[model samples]
Target chain A: MFLNMKTAVAAIALSAMAGSAFARDLVINFDDLNPGPKKGFDDAVALFQKENPDINVIVNINDREAHKTAIRNFLTAEAPDVTSWYPGNRMAPFVDAGLFQPVDDVWEENGFNDDLAAIKPTMSRDGKIWGVPYSYYQWGIYYRKDIFDLLELEEPQTWDELLAACGKMKENGVTPFTIGTKFLWTAAGVFDYLNLRTNGYDVHNALTAGEIKYTDPRIRATFSNWETLINECGFVDNHASMSWQDAIAPFANGDAAMYVMGNFSVDGYKNAGLTEEQIDFMPFPTIDASIPGAEEAPADAFFIPTNAKNVEDAKKFLAFVARPDVQTQWNKTIGQLPINSKADISDDKFIQEGFALLNGASGLAQFFDRDAPAEMAKAGMEGFQEFMLDPSKVDAILERLDTVQAEVYK
Target chain B: MTHAAVPDTTASARPSWVKRNKLAIAPWIFLIPALIFFAIYVVIPIFQSLWLSLYEWNGLYSADGESTATWVGFQNYAKLWDDPNFWTSLRNNLAWLILFMLAVPLGLFIALFLNQTVPGMRFYKSMFFFPFVISQVVVGLIFGWFYNPDFGVVGTLWKAVFCEETTNILGNVTFTCSRPAPDILSSPEWATYGIIAAGLWPQIAYCMILYLTGLNNVAADQIEAARLDGAKGWKMLWYVVVPQLKPATFIAIVVTVIGALRSFDMIAIMTQGGPFGSTNVLSHYMYEVAISEYGERYGYGSSVATVLFGIMLIFISYFLWQMYQDEKGGR
Candidate 1:
């Protein structure tokens, strides 16, 4: 009886040793709890679990807006192993505070430098890559195809052509653009596209970095072009009261024909009962022929917090997310473009069009709000809305923006 | 018995203290819990915000895990002086305070009308009080839809009156109005008034209920006596009914003033201080600066809060003094 008990005890000890070898737990805090993004995130987590069966994954999803505030509290106190955040200056403050871990090792191991070259500059600060970008989408003008066809108008390629098209549309009793600046960021999309088209990528960067003033002649030129757009290409009436979703009403009803928006708005248009044939994407018209074509493409990425308990697992998850196949599947599910250059894009027309537009661009800007500091972006977007409402306030708006820029950067 | 009797001396001594100070100490003993909660939740935070106003913090931590607060004495106040948004918010706040007072007279008028006996009168009174039961967020949303320029009631009315069906370059059916319809929530000049109107819907209901209760307690004999003395209609209401309803009027004014100052949630839900920050009040402006998605300028926000607090202090102190005098006279 003693010999049998000893053998049973030995067997239990051996199994416990085996269990200890693979004991690993990873926690991920994702921001978007919306249906599409949530499903995509769950699928990714499920796939990760299937690959590493022994590792346990804890996924905590939060509403996107609430996450914005909760992140400040969570990052300092009880950080997850990995958390989703934006790239560029949005991550700069956290990176500077050493809350986010530098994932250069993961990038090097996964050969992300070549694949994510387009977004590398945004993800890097102080010579270190802070996060792994999974998906990004291009911003452009989504216009009514039926309107263009009826007017016998081809897509405008230059500033003058766009203006002429706007004039013609106006004569036909259709507003050229529909924007809801109630949330303030929609106005910034217009400002970013104009600035990127008028000044090259360098000037745009310099302005957002606060190396140049808003009153600079280059920025003023951008605003002047914006003034022309506001005057010639009139937006929907009472736009400041409508949300981005609410603005879709006028567009869907054909009261407005064009919108300066992102690829995500395609789904919104579709959900608003607009058909696939009714909508088409075009790059923002060029203002200066000498300036190269650069586009605004905001990226969503995941980062490891410095206080993460499972650093190795977080790095592994990031590397897995960087895989071309994983990125392709994730972006396809969410209807956005994968950051991986080698990733396969679906044949959806808008996605195909956005891919081509971003690939051919000289550089990618992360939109005005993402590229600029949060404080500066807020004031800047408000100024843009003010300018859109009353073009005559351009000088005063620029002066105010300059003052805010000085204060923010200092 | 000798071994068990230990603390009877202390127990006996405690009864003398209790007997001598029971009147003075009993009320305080009953009040300690409430006073503790009041100090913790209310009194402490006011001073905390005041202290926080002198420092610049991003609501984040430094690399060393310390709070990222840098002392900047009156710089935030100095900045507030130059901020155009501040002046706009202050002006809107004043407008709200003045306009929201209309609820008092309107509520009293409704209360007087509903004071009469009629069939299903309880239902009517409850219906009139319905706006008070619904939350401000819901009211803002309902009003938001009511003011929508697309499918809203006002929009539909305007369309029927002025719009003509037209096909555009898009080859789709659309309506072109003779003139742009009034979109109160979107217009900078009109947004504050629109929100104030929505707010007053509930405020009026609240004041109405207050007056309704006061009307229930009115001396019918005295009212009849005034009527016998030839008081009628406006004179009867002004001299007899209104004079008797002074308590209700005072309470209504006090609550209306407080509601006007605490007009943050309505503005937050409705326009978010939008239409170029023209709808901002001090509270919403403070939130926009300190805690909103923009960025945490804690010092700047706290300074705004400090200014708001300073303004409220003047009225509150006067209110407290009045209450103190009333209490002394009653005693």
Candidate 2:
């Protein structure tokens, strides 16, 4: 009689468990190393778990470096229902191979199409939406306000005025520009800005895509301007030997004055124990006021695999994450602007400035690594480093880049 | 007729087969596990790496949407031949090899000094041998920080003494006669040499311990005998104590050569082949191309790896031959 009673209770418990597991399985893989993003990810996972008590949610988190190497493997085997990937050409080859699921109808159905007009270009290719953008930050100059004040220089609005300000900073015993090119991509930040200002967005895109050659007269002018920066206004000392963090040592010491970096570095500066008032942010000075197109746009997006078992769930999650409230919460935790227009943001000073700059962008091009194919971007950046070290090698470097482009594209 | 049932084992009837071949056959049984381990770890991977060298891959991605790699044949090898970076890496390897040999004699001299039995000599021996027992990674990092020009101890010393305007090395500078101390790790021309010097720190320590052990076993009675016939100083040391150090010198050379070739970690830590690929040795360069980042030229990277393997094989074969000659002579 006692055994029979125990069996009845066990059966009831088992059935209850089965009924609860009937909820959808949502698997998410995220790549974020910073503290803010990690918290945002954990908070979102908690909320998501609470909302769907029956669903079994699994989160796979990985380091950013490991994620870059693992992304290719994950796409084919043991693929997460949804994963994070970069935008532009980094997405192109994978998209072409049918490795990604199309989220277009979701865009139209979930109101993302009408609401996210600014980011649709990042998510769109050939009229089909491949991914959903979560968050993005503007790239620009982060300078030392104290040094500028000491030199009696106001923020420069024109190119010539910026150079004159730099000249004054140099005379007062401060490095006009400070960056670590030991890893080489920091130099590309300078180059990309110059290219955007010199040739506008379409031509910059064309150059990276191999449709235009580096030796073209337009590229030559960009190099000429770059050479002028290196020659006339010297950059930080020993830039070749330093990583980005190592370069910050000089900046924190007030030995160097300016760094052109993404908003991601704001937290790093704060962690370095600098007062917020000491540092200031500004956009790259415009080259031609009349030359138009996306002044700056580099975004991070999420996409679904073409071979996924849970496409419906994946699209639903993408749509769910795209909601204005979700965007607002995630971006607030991550210190970046949300892609959604309706998200209510804290009237934080930095976000307000970033939003104004973003909304006013004449054009938006993906970051160089995203805008160009992986192979071309890598070779081009290596050339950028070599060009900076010795401007005389510009012709050779351009020729080599062209050769790499021909081979890589083929 | 008794051996007919088990010819290999002596047919079991004539007093047990184990009695006849126990010396020879027992050894094979004893060595089986070790041979299996060798086959599993060391022997098979060599042939596998050789085979892998023929293909191109990102070391990620598989065919079924699982980061699959595509196979490209001689394209990797062909590209390796065309790459300027490959050539630069090879040249740097050769440079490392040539310079790293200096540690052997330096180690010998230090070992000779520490071989004495004065008061607290054991403590001195341990102190001298300290660098070798610690990890190579730590050694590399210490040297890296030590070479920092701004706050590095060596730099500070150099600046205080050599850069003093009152005592300039080359007195021709205008106003400030002091020239700055060299940025050893930063300059491409000297960066590989800097890493080699760092590598030598542990290697010298290693060689010193080996020589100390060899010296302890040297035939002292023979040295006393040689002294009876007027052998002294340079002659006594050269014709007598030097020859007895053959075993230690053999190990010292083998390890030093192998250490010079296996320079991946130190290079990775100290200088990542920067300043536009100036200090790249073949090993690090191959890794950078084959695996790091989204580097997709697996085939070309493999070709460089194969070429490095071939060079190492030549050195390994020669070193083994030398060891074989010594063993046969000693026997």
True contacts kept of each: 0.66, 0.29
lDDT of 1 by residue, A1-410 (tens): 35324433543354344454337768788889788897888788778776776666777778899788888988888888999999989998788778898999998988999998989999999999999988999999999998888778899999999999999999888898999988999999999999999998999999999999999999999999988888898899888878899899889988899999999999899999999999999999999999999999999999999989999999999999988999989988999999899999988999999999989988999988889998899889888888888989999999999999889999
CAPRI grade, predicted model 1: medium
Task: Please give each candidate's TM-score.
Answer: 0.94, 0.88
lDDT (tens digit, per residue) of candidate 1 on B1-331: 6555656766676677778798999999999999999999999999989999999888888534788788998888999999899999999989999999999999999999999999999999999999999999999999988987777887889999999878765567788889988988878888899999999999999999999999998999999999899989999999889988988998899899889999998899999998778899999999999999885788889999999999888878888888898789989
Q: Could you say which candidate leads in DockQ?
A: 1
CA lDDT for candidate 2:
0.77
Instruction: State residue B265's C-alpha deviation in candidate 1, in Å.
Output: 1.6
Backbone clash pairs for candidate 1 read none
Residue runs of model 2 more than 4 Å from their true location after superposition: A1-22, A51-54, A92-98, A121-128, A293-297, B1-30, B60-71, B154-181
Kindly list the per-residue Cα lDDT of model 2 for residues B1-331, writing each as its tens digit.
Answer: 6566567574455656677788989889999999999999987876766677777554544325343355676777777777777888989888888877877788889998887779999999888889898888898889988987655776677767765433111122211215655667767678888889999988999999988889989998999999998999889878998899988888888888888878888888877777667778888887777776636556666677788889999989998898889789989
Give me the runs in candidate 1 sitting further than 4 Å from their true place: A1-21, B1-15, B169-171
Cα shift from native, residue B163, model 1 (Å): 1.8
DockQ of 2: 0.26
Model 1 fnat value: 0.66
